[model samples]
Target chain A: MRWINVLPGVLVTFALLLPAPAAAKTELYSALGEEAGISRLMETFLLEIAADERIVEHFIDTDIERLHRLLTEQICELVGGPCVYSGEDMVTVHTGMGISHAEFNALVENLMTAMDAEGIPVGAQNQLLALLAEMHPEVVKL
Target chain B: MHTNKFVGVALAGLALAVVQPVYADQGRFIATGAATTIDGAGGGGIVPWATLSSYAEEGQWGATASLTEVNVDDFALSVSAASLTFDNRFEFSIARQRFDLSTIGGELEQDIIGVKTRLYGDLIYGDLPQISAGIQYKKNRRFDLPSAVGAVDDSGLDYYVSAAKAWLDGPFHRTWLANVTLRATRANQTGLLGFGGDQNDDYKLMTEAAVGMFINRHWAVGMEYKQKPNNLSFADEQHWRDYFVAYFPTKSVALVAAYADLGSIAGLDAQEGIYVSLQATF
Candidate 1:
């Protein structure tokens, strides 16, 4: 008997017909700069190592720019992007460095810090490191 | 078949008797320091194949006691271990294992004492789980049995170091964990460690790897593959492989169910059987 009551029902019907809200998708990699961001993070990581007196000698005479490119390519390949890494095999690159487990661990810590500074989520950081950890036996002698 | 059945029943009774006393809710002595779940039955500390030691905070101590029995047609093994941990980071353990062989009609026993240190990382790390190292010195206990197999030595030293990683989410997720352990030892056999043989030829450069998934907080399923040397004059030893499922209603109570495919024992192929374990931790 009330036209106002019918109007409310009509509004409810209209609302039900509208599309539902979309669900959020899980991202595989960080949204920040993706490639560029990763490159910058790697640069910062190398810089930290360069500044550390304990490990600076390992990268003496090294080309930071080329290392950055190769590392970026490697990360991209590992994170499901379209990139091929032509860098030296992990064992070959680290051969005869006499790198101790402590040094390798220090490098890992530096990388983690750099990743944090770039705002990479903890999950993504771990995912990236897991791909690289297979080199432990080759990189650390003891 | 009847004799084998009778032996099985006897072994089952022994297992029941050995495990029942340790089932009390509290104040029962338990193995503390060494890896708690090293046997693939989830309980407290990490097993060799599970994640490494992420011992709890300082002054938190853990102790555990375990009994294991392995029986075949001609041989039987009984192993008991007690260990203590300090600060969840350092552990000391003592274990005794006895082997009785019908073919030789003799029994051998050994006492093992060891210490473990958590090097780095946690059991379930946010980024990279922890890594740890352990070394055990085994002293042979003197005993006399029917001597048919040559004189057996009971004392030896063994060492192992391992690294592990846990994933919160990925293809593996929180349910997925991986570990690799390198062990060097001069012991004649794996004894209770899962493989067996003599001290010299039995000394092994071994590797153990495992992957586990927690179905829920209180339950987990995992598989362990161990590679060891075949060093026995009496019989050729086969590599060890086992798949196990564990139930933990609480951190202090656990039960493990496993089916072991023990490749060869005394030159027999495919010595497979089921294993069950119940453990209480304090």
Candidate 2:
């Protein structure tokens, strides 16, 4: 292709990679409702997990209350809230569970549904999902 | 109409639809199964990306049927295609294309068979981009126009490698996906005008790409570009481009509309128009 025709394509690609405007920098911790919001969200998320047939089996024998608490803490820490994750590392916790990628995606889907039910904005939801998705390799098939 | 195999597959697809409950475990997330390309491969409207056709994740089977129409200034193209994916790892697709030469009269037709395999990575997970390799065998059933235009072969093969990636937290806090492809081919106007030519018979390397942003989960706006080889000596072949909007109302259906500029084809200049496609995933 000629340089002129190629220019627009290059420009559009650069536009795709462009950084978000300064106004997009909403604090995730605050957007997710801090301690009270995180706690409520975790409760809703656990409820979703319980209802989801795809991933419900994994938690059948586990303590629901404790799992909820650790999840809240993990999200709080990951989103820069005033807390640290109290649970074991992702790899260690998921090791030998034989979790498939499909099951992992189901968990994520349920989480998204929970976030939607909590009325979280799309931006904030994506921010939280990004943080969690980083743990995919560590959690799946570990 | 080169269609016996397509009839069987279409029937199978209908039966699968009737038994949708049995395959309800198609586990991939919404919008992960990319749209079928014009050439019948899984990807964007025109540029095939690294992504597969349907939402079949691990231990699942998924299939899709699609119809695409592109109306340009002096020509019109209609494509009917179907694809099947397994375990999100491999994709097999078939397509038939009919090009109406409105300005010059008559029609040209071709059939294509494609296979794509996901080689590495994930489109939305981890750091690395999803990578894949694909091959397409194109057979032009109508070769009279091609012969007059100096094309040497009625069939050809295209080999391509593609990589695609998405960022959930992209610019403006909206999700975005980008794909780049490298292809080797000797096809003239994607084999509709036949393969090889008086000017060039050797496969020429080409680059294709697509970039899009999801305004929300169901609505996405994007652009695609495909570089072409000018093989025929009768008329100059130009690159193709389109800007499109794709909607995923649900995992089972997608609608895409675009404005495409085909530049020139078979001596017709400034050929540009609307492109529309509908896809049903089963």
Candidate 3:
């Protein structure tokens, strides 16, 4: 086992290097082009959700206009932008939705597509994804 | 005798058997699942990771079919594999491994059935890394070569526990994945040359690891190392390693290319090769 000891070292490194998303929040917020950019991104993301049949059913009865505003504000606050989120909490909003993991993932992919369309850098996109992925437990109770 | 058809039909049947009970879809994110290993486990080419196969998230069934080829200096190996993942937690896999001895002019074959279950945590989320426990049951169809080479058994079982983690913003701010696995086994040359031997008949604990980063949503590159036990005295087996590039064009299809250094095979040294695999996820 000449190289047997290498993996533990690498695993420890990966563990220790888990980035602090808070450290780069404002910079990331700026990278997402601030509130206007986020608003544009939200528009694109909602359009994607509207088009995708897998997840569209979840939002059919909701208010798209208010949902758009709330998403924009939520993302703005999450990225450390100036705007504050005024929407209901994730669990509260999603409590009775019965959202499955597949639907959650589908929406995440749509958001990724939206970010790509917005021309967000991969690094910035990942940063945002890390923040949003945290809501998975809250959104999909199962 | 017909390894391809056998594995394909068996795997597909297993998947369809479970289809009526669960909704199947590409639920997980792209490249989140590990590639199918030669041993028919979900992981890198040689080492199994904690991540399950395919894009099956919770409450979904994800099925896949894969074909892999390894052309080495002394041997050419082909593996036909398929797996079904359910509820993002359990994986059932089957594979047919054919090891062709290019120099010896004979071939060795085996069929493997594996089951893996997620024990705790999420691969990309929270404080703990994703952890899983699995077992592979391997039965060698052609045992003559193994028997002649001091192998003691025609079949064996391997049990393993693995932990894996991913950082969305890692080195270079790209998504990175790392995994470590510990396996207990007595299989010789991953069971193609049989199980147990004159040198060691008891199961030994072996460590395997894999690490890689997704350069983007569509492409990833990584490397793996698998430690093997020296069960047979006739040929001193060395560990195996490989560096691989994986491409996931969509959630439904994946392709992997790798350069493997198998170290030694039945007294043959420096057995290196090119490994290519194609996988389809449903």
Listed for each candidate, the true contacts retained, as a fraction, are 0.01, 0.55, 0.48
With a 3 Å backbone cut-off (N, CA, C), the pairs that clash in candidate 2 are none
Question: Number of backbone collisions per candidate, in order?
Answer: 22, 0, 0
Please give the lDDT score for candidate 1: 0.55
Candidates' C-alpha lDDT: 0.55, 0.86, 0.86
- Which sections of candidate 1 miss by over 4 Å? A1-142, B1-55, B71-74, B102-105, B142-152, B170-174, B191-203
List, residue by residue over B150-253, the lDDT tens digit for candidate 1: 32544556778876655434343223556667788644345432223343435567776665555534566766666555645556666665567766554454
* Clash pairs (backbone) in predicted model 3: none
| Each prediction's TM-score versus the true structure | 0.53, 0.91, 0.91
lDDT of 3 by residue, A5-116 (tens): 3654475466546664453889998999999999999999999999988889888799999999999999999988888899889989999888887788889899999999
- The stretch of ten residues in a row with the least summed lDDT in candidate 3 chain B is B15-24
lDDT, candidate 2, B1-282, per-residue tens = 213433443454444434434346668878889798999999989899999989899788899999888889888888999999998999999999999998799999999999999999998897678999999999998899998899999999999999988888888778888899999999999999999999999999999988898987888998898999999888999999888999886777777878998998999998998887777888
- Tens-place lDDT per residue, model 3, B41-143, is 8888999899999888887788888888887898988899999999889999999999989898899999999999999998977857899999999999989
Candidate 3: what is its chain A TM-score? 0.88
Best by DockQ: 2
lDDT of 1 at A142: 29
Better of 2 and 3 by DockQ: 2
* Model 3 DockQ class: medium
